[model samples]
Target: MTEVPLIAPLWTVQDVSEYLRVPVQTLYSWRSSGTGPPARRVGKYLRYRPDDVLRWLESLDDGAA
Candidate 1:
């Protein structure tokens, strides 16, 4: 028998907002504008990959203009 980890690090819009210090409404706007981190839709809910978010942050810092 394998032990499963409880409480994954998956984040909702609110979580992302807290992490990024942005408003949840901005997250929604970014999601719709296709300017946010690539996300996986889990049952109609947006789920962001931590790696993707980090990468996005790095890219932005690198002047991805």
Candidate 2:
């Protein structure tokens, strides 16, 4: 039998803010400025992939060094 891996749920703006320890407004500002983790527009809401968020954080670390 083959095993399947579980998938993570898409994150909301509030979820990303809490995870990154930033204000929700900051995320909105970053989004507008095109300097934050990538997000998708789903209907009237923005959704983020957890993997993309982690990659963005890692990129920051890479740039800092």
Candidate 3:
């Protein structure tokens, strides 16, 4: 039997925007300002880990309290 590696699919800027209910432009702005969820430069595009996005959202909750 061969074991397969499990990897979560990274999200595109549009995917993140849709999930967060923000405008696509807003995500780009946040990226420029260095205030959005952490992203990686893959080739010439930005990719986000789902865990990082969820963690960022949880951090916002922490700041609210």
Candidate 1: pairs in clash: none
* Residue-level error in angstroms, candidate 3, position 63: 7.3
What's the distance in Å from true for residue 65, model 1? 15
Evaluated against the true structure, the overall lDDT of model 1 is 0.82
Total clashing residue pairs per candidate?
0, 0, 0
Candidates in order, TM-scores: namely 0.74, 0.84, 0.86
**Over the stretch 1-65, how does candidate 1's per-residue lDDT look in tens digits?**
99988755877777788888999999889989999877789998888877788788777755546
Error of 2 at 24 (Å): 0.4
Q: Model 3 off-target regions past 4 Å?
A: 61-65
Q: Pick the candidate with the highest TM-score.
A: 3
Displacement of residue 12 (Cα, Å) in model 3 is 0.4
Model 3 weakest 10-residue run by lDDT = 56-65
Worst 10 residues of 1 by lDDT: 56-65
Error at 36, model 1, angstroms: 1.2
In model 2, pairs of residues that clash are none
Mind giving the per-residue lDDT tens digits that candidate 2 earns over 1-65?
A: 99989999999999999999999999999999999999999999999999999999888855544
